[model samples]
Target chain A: MSIGQETVLEANEARVVYNEDSDNPVEAVRSISLDLRKGEVLALVGPSGCGKTTLFNAIAGLIPLQGGRVSVGGIEVEKASGHVGYMLQKDLLLPWRSVIDNVTLGLEVRGKPKGEAKKIAQELIERYGLGGFEHSKPSGLSGGMRQRVALMRTLAFEPEVILLDEPFSALDFQTRILLQSDVKRIIREEGKSVILITHDIGEAISMANRIVVLTNRPATVKTVHEVPWGDEVTDPVAVRDRPEYQEMFSTIWQELELTNGQQGKTMKGAA
Target chain B: MAMATDIGEAKKQTAAPPAPKRRPRNSTGRLRIMAYQVAVLIAIVAVWQIGLWTGTLKPYVYGTPWGVMQAFAEQIANGTLLRHFWVTGQEVIIGFVIGCSLGSLCGLMLWLSPLWAKILHPYMIALNGVPKIALAPLIIVWFGLGMESKIAIAAIITFIVAFLQAYKGTQEVDQDLIRLMKSLGATQWQTFRKIVMPGSVPWIVSALRLNVGFALIGAVVGEYISAEEGLGYMVYYAGQLYDLDSVWVGIFSLMFMALILEAVVARIEKMLDMEK
Candidate 1:
């Protein structure tokens, strides 16, 4: 707890309940507290349908929490409107729009003048290896290219913290690894705080400086591990080759399996 | 020698198959289809002429091909057909403009206000369910036997088709895109303009294509009931007088007009890039 990192985002005892008053009310997240530090990538890893996404949504101010609070740069998150940059599992690029137009979407929504937005979008596109595709439609781009465009779009808005909800899950295995390093490098260069929600443990370990493992439904943080790889480990691919990678992977896997076993036992007892 | 033969056989098996032959050009296929259509039309006209010459068909009842052509020429020479064609064309154009605008506007309004849509849903269904041709008499009575009645009828018919198409299109827009826009801090109006309106362009164009036919139907139906001038009136007058050739001329003119309208709508759809 005394790692001496400056906190960029904090979620305190955050709780989320769906259909609060209905006959079959469901609690998705329960009293989860965590901190995201400046210039660090925090990955949330858990079982499927474990409310990791729900927590991400709460942190992004997309959904109202029943209790507790989420703050970015010490300011309370009231709503999603211009608060956090969010990337969903799908690219969600507008098909009718060209690549540059889609990238400038956030700026356009903010009412930035067209010329200024286009200039910024053009620079981002060229900077991120998406040059020569400024006018191509989203349909024409490959999956990895499209995701890069989406990332560039989020970056263009310059939010305090970025919430990535399984942004690489839809990509192929090779592309996922490549993008993992690419995104990590870009984010590190920008020096932005990010909270990545991922089901893939390898992805979590590869990209994140810290990982939070959570329990199934009504999810709570089961454990938090700080990645021990030092500053020399700049590339995600290089980090995977280190001798400590397998050990860390197995440790997190065991933690996940423990929760799975507990849930299985509970189901058996009920049946 | 046996080993060499086996190697050659293996290579033959592993080699890629020959590429399939390319199909004939699409333009050639289209030309062939057109030729067949023309032949069918010529054959039908030839049979009609032969039957008339053999006295097996009554020219007064079915009308000979030559007689129909003569009637067409006579009408053109006298300028009556041109006048009637102009009247019907005017009614259709005015009615299409009014109907398309109102339908698109109302459809957009309903999309923005679901409460209004729910309240008016049943009434819309009821209005659309009634055969618009049945309303011809009432329309003429209200708007009179002039071009006003024809235009009114055409407008109502076009309105129903256009409204339904636009409404469906608006409803079917990608929810994900809307959510993305909202997350970007877009206001409700900006979302509607940038996402909803552009998304519905295909539906609006399709509606325009369908409404062209509806507009023509409404105009002709209104003219059939009571009108001083129009192709429909000519048809009705010719039928009453047992001038079958003149009736055929009127029908052909309406068909030709419909084709032209459809082509114009298709061109507009292309310009809008609705196919993309």
Candidate 2:
């Protein structure tokens, strides 16, 4: 697979630690180094608190990196302006604002005068099957519809890179499967690079070209699998139903379960 | 978990049920509960009327239901009630608005600026502990015995409540949302306006309702210290004159206003939920 750019986002010797109340801090991620090429999808998967999120935070400049550096589109992570879009798990839409307003929030925040930003947001919403929902509140939406709005909101800024922090984790299996496909289609159609974080191996297998699995907290890259899922345009949900999909899921599941079972007790010592 | 399994088993046992060949049998039980409440209210009234009629209670100690209503009616007829109503109402409304706005602003500011939040958080905590009641006299001294004093006192009391709630609410914002905003290169202000403020609305509204009560208390207490007008003054003066009926009327009026504020706040809460 050819990435649009050589190094759209690259992290060198990145490490993160979390300190809570005491001098002793838990090293969540230990020295992760990876490159996210433009238009390619990289999936990060591991046990809970294995620093998948910490890596995302470090890359997004939400948290300071204890060690090493991150660069996005040749710019340092700290100065990565309008370079990344994030899709959170909860889809935290403003209750008082309509779908259009929620979708256009990033643009509005970035000072793209309301008229044009709103027009663009509306087009995206309708293009993504949320036309009638433009005026509806988050409460007026189904879980899937709300996620779509959340996706649109993130996309409003037209980021060079996208980070999806378990965007479909909160949905039921059926809706999760469906939204995964929509999300992939939307991203590919927009030609954006993506880094997806999830615990679901099946999800990583179906959505990402590269899957990086982390060990327990004080995590390092346990393994990075280059999954060659047949075609990019094929339906993700349909792929999940295929027997080949189950084989990948079973293999990935065992790998995760093995590492989790062995290293679960050592994380506390690391902390 | 067992219940879920039982439901699944039950679904398998029967594909469908007779359109609930039954309705709830608690209708009579609900009626009984309602009758019990009426009976209790009637018993309390009867005891009061009996005390008045038998001269078992002194007139100065407490006002009978009829006496209180009569005093309320008289106050209404003389147009005196309107003046006092305006005074107290003004203090409450102005204080509520000013206090809630300032508190919310301060809280949002604190949330946005961690340095300020750290600097002011402890000082604010100390202020919260300073007892606004004790500050009532100081407020009157500073702002004089006019409505401004009461308004100032009420606003201070209301502001603290809101500030605490909004601060805590802002802290509770989902990191996920913050990441989303940051990914889009939203400035700190934009993050607050787009993510933090909306997230804090429920908390702020709760503070507003709570502070409304505090505002009323502050205004009334401040009035009790010094005020030529307002229901607080009426109640205090009536107490000195040993006119319990007038006192009761003032108390009931304040209680009624509180209920109205509560209803308004509740309506807002419901509206927010529905919108969400």
Candidate 3:
């Protein structure tokens, strides 16, 4: 709403269709447009099968758009662009690799010298409380710690925009809240912009500066709500304690509830 | 058995609850299983020994276990067993290295080129379907009646096995991980090096494990067909002379060689951290 902040990522009428050549082609995302501002967390929330992941993949340039464009730093995104770092729902850490090796995978793939990559990975590991677990495998780590390692890996490359696709969903509620705060703090401290895709309204309200709600399949932008949090409440767990957090959560919940009801009625009518 | 069960029940009752009974039970199970295996082997040997001593079975045909041991000792004392063992061992090792390296490399190449993979898929399947031991005569003809023929036969067998496994390994890599690597701006080579290669280590190690026996089979078969040396030649020579004890010695030596090679491959798998 304000022209004060800089836009780091912009998606212009992005469209995605699955099995486009087949007779039963499914349109996953239908012309959704949004912007990720500099140093701000933008959460995209929607119901199941809403193509939030499809949009996230498009933004990350993992999939080509049927229509419109997604760009970071004014450069059009393409497959394997390295302009943005993506953390998927699953940690996707290489089980065979040690924590440090897994974290520095991107750097090594990008052809950074091994010593330099390890140094960068080491610093991130120490900073993110994964200090002593450097040589440990992903199988040896707890779910939350694995996610932390995943986050550190995403940050190891220091891309302009980070795309998180339900990164904390697999964790227990307590760990999820704690990790939300940790990730928010780390992202903010590093001055990186993030586009977080989640189905959890509370997570969206607590972690993001702006929340983009989407409609069910053939997903389109429903509405965007700027989180009404004070500057002092940076921690997601602390933000949850604020009265505004609940109010915003209820508001988004109602929006989702209405969509669910409509879908139920439509299904019943079909039956 | 009833008395033993009662004593076990009494001990269980006396033992504190939640005292980690699992450890002792597991150890006992392992010990019992090992004892049963040893007993089975000893019983078979004992039966054979009794039959021979009672003249129920001819020692000339089946050979006495003691006679086999004596023959083994005689060969060892004269260093003939060691000489033949070294020759066969060298063939197996050299063939395994050549076959595994070339096979995995070819597999990777095919994976990198889907067109080549498509073209070669049927041929590979056909080659794999053929019993590689049947190629012994052809191999001997091509490479001559020396260790070269044995090595060639070994290499061919191991190559087919390793290639198929490595190809399957490459295909089985997680597509999600590939996409993740691609999103990181990794080039194709980078993805293959950092993700595909490391991911396929388990499959490659398994292939290597299987190839160990295959290479030995190839070498032994080659020697059976034409070689003047090797444990296979010893078996052939012993069989021709009706020296069943020496034949058993040769056969046992080949089995021992296979087990040792498999153990080495397993150790390498452990070093690669591919073992589950």
Q: How should the candidates be ordered by DockQ, best one leading?
A: 3, 2, 1
DockQ of 3: 0.49
- Indicate whether candidate 1 or candidate 2 has the larger TM-score: 1
lDDT of 1 by residue, A158-217 (tens): 988888999999999999989999999899888888899998888898888899999988
Q: What tier of docking accuracy does candidate 2 attain?
A: acceptable
Q: Largest DockQ belongs to which candidate?
A: 3
Tens digits of per-residue lDDT, candidate 2, B108-198, equal: 7787777776666556656656666777888899999899999999998778777776776777677667766776677888788778888
Q: List each candidate's DockQ score.
A: 0.34, 0.44, 0.49
User: For all the candidates, what are their Cα RMSDs to the real structure?
Assistant: 11.2, 9.2, 9.6
List runs of model 2 lying over 4 Å from the truth: A1-6, A17-25, A229-233, A240-247, A264-271, B1-47, B69-79, B257-276
Instruction: Evaluate candidate 3 by giving its C-alpha RMSD to the native, one decimal.
Output: 9.6
lDDT of 3 by residue, B1-276 (tens): 232233223321111111212444587899998999999989999999999889999999899899999999999999999999999999999999999999987876666776777777667656766777888898889999889989999998888777776766677677788889888988888888877787777778778877888898899888888878999999999999999999999999999998899889867866776422
Q: What are the Cα lDDT values of the candidates?
A: 0.84, 0.80, 0.85
**Candidate with more favorable, higher lDDT: 2 or 3:** 3
C-alpha RMSD between model 1 and the true structure? 11.2
